[model samples]
Target: MKNRVEILAPAGSYEVFLAVMNAGADAVYLAGNMFGARAYAGNLNNEELIKAIEYCKFHNKKMYLTVNTLLKNNEINNELYDYLLPLYNSGLDGVIVQDYGVMKFIHESFPDMEIHASTQMTITDSGYADFLRKYNVTRIVPARELGLEEIRDIHDRTGMEIECFVHGALCYCYSGLCLMSSFIGGRSGNRGRCAQTCRLDFNYNGRESKILSLKDLCTLDILPEIIEAGVFSLKIEGRMKSAEYAAGVTSIYRKYVDMYLNKGKETYKVDKKDRNRLLMLFDRGGQTDGYYMRHNGREMIADNTKISKDLGEKKQYEEYIHRTFVEANPKIKINGIVTIKKNNPVTMSLSFGNIAITIDGPTCETALNRAVSREDVDKQLRKMGQTMFELDTLDIRMEDNIFIPLKSLNELRRTAVDRLTDAYLEASKRNNSHRFLPCAAHKESRNKGISVHVLTYEQADEAVKHNIQRMVIDTEVMSGDEISRCVELCRKNNVKSYIGLPRVDRGTYNVKSNSDGYMIRNMSQKTKCDKEVIADYCIYAFNNYAVSALEDYGITGITYPLELNEKELSEMDIDNGELVVYGRIPLMITANCIDKTSGNCHKGSTLFSMLRDRKNALLPVLTCCKFCYNIIYNSVPVYLFDKLDRIRIQPEYYGIIFTTENATEVADVFKCFNNRTKPEDNTFTRGHFTRGVE
Candidate 1:
């Protein structure tokens, strides 16, 4: 038989784990008490996780641990090994990783454990998938923006396993690249403490709407197509969701996956009853098919889902819980033998999975009353209730007239079961003992030149004319002949050019292979171009290990993560690293367009508006309507011109990003950066360069 696709579910707690497994998930992803992207979830502890693993193993399912949060240098150095060691030994099937440092450490130390690239990595294409293959990443969870064709192409070209999100809540910003919550409220999403700022209401052009909220994804009708595209795993995203939601979603997906597997493509059909149950379970706005079909369309927006918000739906969820979690769990049957003798010890031996445990109870005495009947012995032995095991068979070779206390039998059974449980846990154990090897340091940077990032050809022309010498053009803004002209203008002015890829490119990539190089804003870009790649900060080379790991992929240069402060930067080699010294840093690169929600769609024109938050700060919303994405920029651009003195180490270049700025503003910003001075007006922030993220 052909291998069936995996239906992966999320588990926030042990109860949810059981619900998911019983609902028919082939594998479940969960986080321990720490180091998971869903930090708010009621995650598992070490002991509970171990038990969860063993339970899955016993039930013929798999459990993948989520270590998919970015770690600080201190956390990696102090807490990584201790937190993961026991779980690794307890036979964790796989680990979903977001941090490159975490990936390298785990892969080198364990070597055999499977590493899955988490969606937080924002992987979008085959090249990015291939880049991770050397690090022993067995699977890639591509950014949700990728279409079916893109997913199939990634799998076919890379020959690596592809996993996609088929259903559940969708993030407004592309995963791994969001920093809005951190910038606004000092809670970092990359560190797993997202405040979900996207779900809140914002005023845009006098319209109050949840501008950043996207409808939950539902792909029930397209399961066969997704499977046909060679997606090995279909994942549901809800680690922070409730157990009822877990059971309901898992049960529906499981039923369909089995139906497809058993009935084949010709007979595969999406049942209407299953669809209605899913709709009743939960939805945001309504449901969108997501970016799987086309690039940017209004259909994907989840502006209003008030129907699912009704409290009456709570009863539906409870019914699902009752039907799934309230059902009886499967039991393990063991053939037990009990022996009783006169004036000697009575021993009971139990066997299970290559391990056997024998318990000796109080010695039997000569019968003072009627001899213990067979029915009495059977009834006592069959009380293996509420445990994983049941009394499938019980053999009694009792000494004639030997009397045994009823309490002793109960004690013998309980002891044997407890010992068997431990034996089973040991049988599923794995071992990891290797230590991490550190990378050698590089020389410090000697030069710090200025590079301008422009969003349009006009800006690119002006940038090169001003002898900026280096220009990064946003590809979403420049396309076809305009893109070619930007490159031509840069080359004519003896200015090196780099194509700034969209942070979330899901459609067919139209990158020119002839550019000098590609500024890789996301991992999925490398598969689009074979050019020598420059790593953008969104790729997150946060630690020395992450830098060394990416360097192995032949990446030419790196941009240190913007989250790091001066003290943290001083400790690492910044020779090849570039710093963003000036820019209205993009707070959000999101799919749910604030423009669409601001009722700007009826205008049928592009929108450039401001989202005024509760603080009364107006953040610029840059809409790439064609691409179906919106970038909400910080009200205060990140300007560290004066803070340059605090930076103990230097990088090859300092980058200034221009999103909404005109030619005059761009020139003024560059001049201030060049002179090592602040903007004339006090309209900028020293973002995370002096104070790092939490």
Candidate 2:
């Protein structure tokens, strides 16, 4: 028989874990107390996670832990091993990971543990999936924005197990590429402390609305298509939700998946009541089919109006779900035979599936008052209350006059159940002797130079006139001929020109070969391009191990992550790193176009849009028509020219990114940085240089 696809549910707590498993989830993914994406969720502790592992082993299900957040240098060095060692020994089935440093650490420390690439890795293509094979990543959760064809192509090329999100909330920006929360409030989404800024209201082109909130994904109608697209696991996205939501959603999906497997797609159908139950469980505006069919459209966005659920309907559904799945305690069935005879030790043999155990009790006594009957012994042994096991069948063989004490029978039953549980736990234990090898130390560099990244030729022209050593031209906005012109301009000024690839590579633009190096943002570009490569900050080199991992792929230059404070940066050995001293940091790289959603799309023309928050701050939105993606810039640039003395790490280059600046503004920034003087205006933010993400 062919292996069926897995229904992967989310469990924020132990109760939710049991509820989803009872609701028919093949596997459940959850997080421990740290390094999880949902920091606000009531996560399990180490002991509880071990108990979960044992429970999964007993039930023949699977559990994957979520270590899917980026780790800092100190966290990786001090806390990572201690945090995972217990889970590793308890036979954790797998781990969903986002950071390269965490991947490397788990691979080395827990060799037997399976590593799954999280959606935060933003793996949109097969090349990146193939690149991760070196770290022994057995499965990958691809970016949710990929279409069915793209998902199938990735599976066809890499042959790795693909996990896709079938239902739940969706992020407006590409996962792991969002820095809005971190830049705005110092709550870094990359660190699992997202402020949900996307769900808030914003004004687009003078029309005040929730422009960034996307409708939740619901793909029940296309379940067969998703399975046929080569997905091995269907993932549901809710760890912060209640147990009722977990059980309700998981049970419905389980019902449909089984129906499709048993009765083919032609006979498969969804009941209207089931659909309504899902919405009533937790409604976020309406639901869309997600990016499976179309690239993106206005229909995919939620309406501007608020959606209020009926309190009566919600309460009724919650009670039904709680009683049906949560309060209901499922037990393991056990068949047993009790042997009782006169003047012989009483014993009971219990069998649970293939596992069996026998327990001995006190010696049987002669019948002084009344002999113990089969019915009496059966009644006493059947009291398997508050235990994971249920007595399904029982046989008793008693002598003509045998009297067994009630206390002895109770002890025997308890011992048999305890032994069975112990046997399962012992069977689930794993041993690993692999030692962790730390990355080699990097030499500190004292050389300080300036590099400027430009979006337009005028910015590049003005940038090269200064003492800048390098210029990075964004290929998403500039045409091939325009890039060549910028390269020629840089060449004339004796500046090294580099091509900056798009933040999201949808296989549209080709790598320009005439540049000094390529500035890559994603792993697919990092693996496909054959040139001097500089890893962008979006690649997330938060620790030395991540930097070493990038270097292992032959990447020499990497940009410093913007979320790290100055003290954190100073602690790292940033010899080959480039620190962005000045720039309007791109807060979000979204697949949904702001112009198209607002009914003002300029077709294939690039235009600048504005998004005003409630605080009346205007965020620049760049619509890149070539790649069909949007780049949302911060309200103000990150200026650190005055704080250069406070930054102790002397990276190879001090980089500046010019996004919405004109020719004169670009020249003024370059001159101020060169003179080591602060800008005249106080509008610029210091970014995370003072207070880093928690």
lDDT (Cα atoms) of all candidates against the true structure: 0.80, 0.88
Model 1, range 1-694, lDDT digits (tens) per residue?
3468999999999888888887888999999988998888999989999888888777778889998988777677778878888778888889999999899988888776799999898876676766787787889888887788888987898888888999999887888888899888778999889998878887777767676777889999889889999999999989998888888898889888888888877887888877667777776768878888876566666657355554566686667576757463867888788887889887888887677888888888999988776677777877898887887778887878877878777887888888777877787787745767666788575777767788877677667756575778776665657878888888888877888877777635677746689898776676677687887788888877788777887778788788887888776654677788888888888766665555466333444678988678899877776566778889888888877776676887778787787888767776776677877788788888778877
**Candidate 2: worst-modelled 10 consecutive residues by lDDT:** 426-435
Q: What is the lDDT of residue 458 in candidate 1?
A: 69
Candidates in order, TM-scores: namely 0.89, 0.97
Clashing pairs in 2: none
Best by TM-score: 2
Pairs that clash in candidate 1: 127-527, 285-304, 285-305
The TM-score measured for candidate 1 stands at: 0.89
Cα-lDDT of candidate 2: 0.88
Give the TM-score comparing model 2 with the true structure, all chains together: 0.97
